[model samples]
Target: MSTSTRAGSAAPSIALNFDSIAAARAIVPRLAAISERSEQLRRLDDEAASLLRGSGLARVITPRAFAGLEMSPSAHIRACAEVAHGCAAASWVLMVCVAHDYVIGRFPEACQKEVYEGDADNLIAGALAPQGTLERTPEGWRLNGRWQFGSGCDHSPWLLMGARVANPEAGGYLTYHVVVRQSDMEIDDTWRTLGMRGTGSKDLVARNVLVPDHRAVPTYPTFIGQSPHATAPTYRLPVFAGLPCMLSGSVLGMAEAGLEAFIGHTKSRRDVTGASKSANANMQQRVAESSAEIAAARRLLESACDRFDVAWRR
Candidate 1:
């Protein structure tokens, strides 16, 4: 809900200008500077949120029609990993929010347009687990429920909440993501945890919120890469396969950071015997092993992404 009416995707994104990984790297310093502040605030601070929006990293998986870069899976992974180098909480927020945009792409064109009316980089907060009910109505659907883990909701104006809809024809319930303005639901500040506090994974309560038919998207089709609005191969990559790759980037980044910290600590660390860890053969071996393992993980995750990219292209 970017109400200011400034709409334009970055100019004809060429390879170098639209490199998501580089954009993430540019914001790394700022993200690190505010890491402690974000933790203390129990959510991403204003500056960090601004940095994420300006960096354009969240648009990697967004649709091209809405000024999204629509980059490949590998690119998304690399960008998240880069952000994780500075702060894992920020990385998780970036990754989850980007995926939310991708999900928006799955909605009908009308809904996508309505959601992105103000700007293309509009952020969407989501709670994946289905815990609500949608009752049929003349105007649209009435959504009611209490959902948890609404990550990144502090910054997003739009929210995609999962709910169950009754199917009269099939006599069963189907899962749907009801798109609603963030203000439509009451946000509860219940996210308190020992780690990753900056994610702001709060709880949301919705009481008879009206969701238009176009904005309610099915879960199964999107899961199987069959978006009504998104016809491109990128959106076609079933989330069951693609989401794991997209979310894996943060873990990979955390592992890389852990490796870097170990290397830095050992460089000047002395053992109990007063022997320099850097000079000790066993410590050196451990360092090499950790470095190799991290590298291998990066390669493995990227490789999986690359394969998905290739399949989607065909």
Candidate 2:
């Protein structure tokens, strides 16, 4: 467990000077150039990762008081979608990092200061499924297990993992979470997939690591918009429900990218009968249908995100 070095220090209340969506757009070209390289390496390229960090898109959901933009849900979705247009893997990592920042905000103020006080841009990797076993102790909880699908763990300094904790009073186990430094865990290079291979969804193993009480957070409260800063609209929203929405943007963007590629290839394709695809009625119908589907899906996802934005503001 890593503690804050600045003794008796308060969390910084500085504001960031960057637009989340615009920063994402600026990095699109770099991500696009390295999309294939990322897939081959089974993680994000170094250059692309540097560009993304410099762009300041990873802190979109970080609290503004910590020098983060803390953009709205809809804006965050748009930023992910924009980055996904260049590379789905890059966008996946970006979403994972940003989402973890939001999760960090749900913890106690002391936990927030420990993470953000030293480095505002500290990326956090997370595995949502409760895979670890937790036992209560005087200091805190003892965690030992392996978490899978640790997406974007390559660049994160902290890891947010889920575990099943014993309930002495209730005689049943409940899911809980603890934040730990990346150095406390071991990464297993077991992520090999067909699509989205660049996500680096590796396995993180922790053996008998002790997490302090202040670093622990309950599950139910976080899901129901309970936070230290509950008065703020962003923290008040049902933050967990927004996870699927956060991921939907990348799916839509990837589908759109695939559709565009198919259309471009079709224009130069020739049928067995020696007719160019651009001149073939059947190919034209297929392209039109695919384009319509992509457009409609985009509209639906964007509409849902718009509704989320409305709810956040209210």
Candidate 3:
């Protein structure tokens, strides 16, 4: 698909592709096992994260020119859901990491070149919440602040931090996506949660770090597709259009897991009336209804994704 040229115009030429679906499927069992372990560890272990990297999971959304999959958005969503069914934390980390590539691609070519030059598989971990401060410096900008909820931070070599740039005229905040080497930020192990514990999302602290001007991308300009990389068709796609889908895909996967567990339970469980759960007509109806509901919901989700995919590919 050709990249779009018009400013603020999204390129609707990318098509959905699933050549990597089998590869993704092969890793599901392993991912599920590691997911349980990650929950116990309260973070994804290096070994498991490595497995994902090795499995080509991290490259799903990478541009084809960068030796990454450059897959269609639909395929990306499906892959995320599959992994999520096995482990939501693992899937969440993978989704964010992959999505970062797409976001970074919307930057200037120089920035993209610097990021994907050697290893396209390089992992990026961080958040979009504007939590840091950028002060102008001679060389570039001095960044200082603390960003929380950096998922998969333990394995990333580069971190993308969101911070507010002081706008004197507007008397407001302008968000910036600042690229920092992993060494520049200190990782604080503060991820303790009842759910999604395996994510090991922690806080990242940056203190008086100098970031070159080219390393920072403004968020306000990009919302309307007026980014430095807007000339590239890949950069024209709406940022919010695909993110929620990625998150929802993981939720759908978890729901599928719950449904499966319920099905298994129903087969063996007996109700208070001492009747076999599976043999009870009402229980059978409930299970059937639940199955239908899940199927319908999944179909609706996929259909919406397909519609977006078609538009994106046009």
Candidate 4:
């Protein structure tokens, strides 16, 4: 019955236009109409993408310094789920892109500026599995190797991925907070799947791509939620607490959609035996159980987000 998350970006102006979640909900009909087209394209349809980008949802977690709303976790869940109720792929992209803003907030301010100031309609995709390698460079770092699950890379101009740095001086380590331009990498169209096909979460391959010193930082601090924007409560929450809470929106949305669809279809259904499932006690019991499970999941997710918000406010 409740949620409070918001953030909107009107570049060059620092005003926070709240109600991105409301905007997302308002577009459900339009989004649902184009869901099939997006699914078939194996990526977001142009209209679908535009709706999300224009609705101010993508800027929800962006720092207010960057003209972003820095939306709340509960609102993030509701917004993503609302979009997913229409199209899972679009919701997936929205959550991933906006959550990156939160990640970038922890990055050095220069990196944040390069991203936010560089593009008013910027969207980012990422894979934080540490599958790639980063070599130290005089100017910055050279990225190599391939990373998996580059979701939304097809639609985004930049990517944040994980990489390994072979530091003989300080032993080996992994970095999940590296940023690279989309111009420097290849999307290996290998995202074949049974569901959520619109995600286009393919593999990303880079060869000696440049990642400027300012663009990349020690992942430890970012993961721990250390940020130059000391005044922003949203950026102060650890990535574990913040990003996952937001990203989970897409997953919960899909599950919610599944539950709704199941109930709808079951309400006017018949089995292979031509018996009415609508009148079947077994079917009724199943619906009740599934509804409870889905409801519980939603509660658990929102409760966690609320806890994070309360704790981080101090």
RMSD to the true structure for each prediction, in A, is 4.1, 4.6, 3.8, 5.0
Give the per-residue lDDT of model 1 (tens digit) for 37-72.
Answer: 989999988788888888888777776666666666
Deviating ranges (above 4 Å) for candidate 3: 1-18, 168-173, 272-274, 280-290
Model 2: which ten-residue window has the lowest total lDDT?
5-14
Q: What lDDT does model 2 reach? A: 0.76
Task: List per-prediction Cα lDDT, in the order shown.
Answer: 0.79, 0.76, 0.73, 0.74
Clash pairs, model 3 backbone: 4-233
TM-score per model over all chains:
0.89, 0.89, 0.86, 0.89
Of the candidates numbered 1 and 4, which has the greater lDDT value?
1
Winner on lDDT between 2 and 3 is: 2
Q: What is the descending lDDT order?
A: 1, 2, 4, 3
lDDT of 2 by residue, 210-306 (tens): 9998888777677678755444456666767787888888778788888877878877888889888788887788888988998998898889877
Q: Which ten residues in a row have the lowest lDDT in candidate 4?
A: 1-10
Superposed by TM-score, candidate 4 places the C-alpha of residue 272 at a distance from the truth, in angstroms, of 5.0
Per-residue accuracy of model 3 over 132-235 as CA lDDT, tens digit each: 88777678778889888898888888887888875523323367788888888899889888988888899999999898878887777765556756454445
- Model 4 misses residue 224 by how many Å? 1.1
Point out where model 1 deviates above 4 Å.
1-17, 166-173, 280-282
